[model samples]
Target: MPYVLLAAAIAAEVGGTTAMKYSEGFSRLWPSIATVIGYVLAFALLAQVLKSMSVGTAYAIWAGVGTASIAVIGMLFMGEAAGVARISGIALVIIGVVLLNLGGSH
Candidate 1:
């Protein structure tokens, strides 16, 4: 289903971003290759999702979710700060994505 593809795309995007943190400005070999591969697969799956989903809706979800996911990943696993402001920001992003989907249905 398109939703499944969207989820995969989001996961790939998140993975790519996480790998980017370890890429050391692309100087590292394996992480750099992983980043490129992750993004390639993400875009490919996202393209498939677009076949049935509206661009505004799909892209909003993809970007919003990916951003929020990366933020959380940073806090939880990457030793980034998990301050209140950052948590609030992620909540806002999720709400915005939900609102976008709701509006797009009309």
Candidate 2:
């Protein structure tokens, strides 16, 4: 299903972003390679998903989910601040994504 592919794409994008944190500005070899591979796979999957899905819907979900996931990852695992503003921003992103999907479905 296209949704499955889109989920995979989102996962790949999240992986790539996580790897980027460990990539040390691309100075590290394995993490850098992982980052590149993850991003490539993500785009490939996303491109496939676009064939059956609306671009606006797919892209909105992709960007929003990736962003929210990264923020949570940073807070929980990466020692980033979990301040109220940041959490609220993430919530707003989710809300916006939901609104976009709802609006696009009709």
Candidate 3:
């Protein structure tokens, strides 16, 4: 299903972003390579989902989900700050994604 593909794309994007944090300003070879691979896969899957989805809706969902997921990953696993402002921003991204889905036609 397209939704499944979309989810995969989001996961890939999130993974790529997380890898970026560990890439040490691109000095690390492996993580940097992984980041490139992840992003390539993400864009490929996202393109597939876009075939039948609206550009606005698909991009919004992809970016929102990817951002929220990476934020959680950072808070839970990475030593990133779990401050109220960051959490609130992530919540807003999730809520905005949900609202976009609700407002769109199937």
Candidate 4:
């Protein structure tokens, strides 16, 4: 399904972003490879989702979810800061994504 494809894309993007942090300017071969592969799969899956979803809707969801997920992953795993303000901002992004999806379904 398109939604499933979109979810996979989001996950792939998150994985890519997380790996990218560990890539150390692409010096770490394994993580760098993983980052590339993950990004490729993410885009490929996004293209599939675009076959059924509106470009605007799908793109918004992809970007919103990918960004939020990556931020959370970075905060949790990469020791990146997750202050209250940042968390609130991420929450707003989630709210916006939900609204976009709801509006798109109608």
Candidate 5:
């Protein structure tokens, strides 16, 4: 299903981003390889998702969800500061994605 593909795409994207932090400017081998592979999978899956969904809707969801997930990963695993402003920003991203989907469905 397209939804499944989209979810996969999101996961790959998140994985890719997370790996990027570990990549250390390409000095590491595995993480850099993972980054390339993850991004490839994400884009490939996203292309498939486009077959059924509008570009605007799909892209908004992809970018919004991917960004939000990365931010959470940073806060939880990467020891990034989790201030109220950053949390609120992530919440706004979710809200914006929801609103975009709602409007796009029509």
Candidate 6:
């Protein structure tokens, strides 16, 4: 399904972003490679999903989910800050995404 692929793309994008943090300005070979590969796969899958989905809806969902997931991953694994405000913002983004999907379906 397109939605499943969109989720996969978001996950891949988050993985890529996390890897980028570990890349140390592109000096680390493995993490850099992972970042490149992950982003490429993410975009590819996103393009595939676009074939069946509205561009605006698909892009908004992709960006929202990817941003929220990446923020959580960064906080958990990259020692990034997880301030209350940031968490609350991410929660709002999730809520918006859910509402968007529900509204679009019916």
Best by lDDT: 2
Each model's TM-score? 0.93, 0.94, 0.92, 0.94, 0.95, 0.93
Quantify how close model 4 is to the true structure by its C-alpha RMSD in Å. 1.2
TM-score of 4: 0.94
Candidate 1 RMSD to the real structure: 1.3
TM-score, predicted candidate 1 vs. hidden true structure: 0.93
Better of 2 and 6 by lDDT: 2
Per-residue C-alpha lDDT of model 5 across residues 7-64, encoded as one tens digit per residue: 8999999999999999999889999999999999999999999999888888888999
State each model's C-alpha RMSD to the native: 1.3, 1.3, 1.2, 1.2, 1.1, 1.4
With candidate 5 superimposed using the best TM-score fit, by how many Å does residue 73's alpha carbon deviate from the native? 0.4
Give all candidates' CA lDDT scores. Answer: 0.92, 0.94, 0.91, 0.91, 0.93, 0.91
- Residue-wise C-alpha lDDT for candidate 4, range 1-106, written one tens digit per residue: 8999999999998888888888999999999999999999999999999888998999999999899988888798779999999999999999999999889732
For model 1, name the residue pairs that clash.
none
List the candidate 4 regions with Cα displacement exceeding 4 Å: none
Better of 2 and 5 by TM-score: 5
Angstrom error of the Cα, residue 101, model 2: value is 2.5
Q: Candidate 6, residue 47: CA error in Å?
A: 0.4
lDDT of 1 by residue, 1-106 (tens): 8889999999999999889989999999999999999999999999999989998889889999999999999899989999999999999999999898778622
List residue ranges in candidate 6 displaced over 4 A.
Answer: none
Which stretches of model 5 miss by more than 4 angstroms?
none
Please give the lDDT score for candidate 6. 0.91
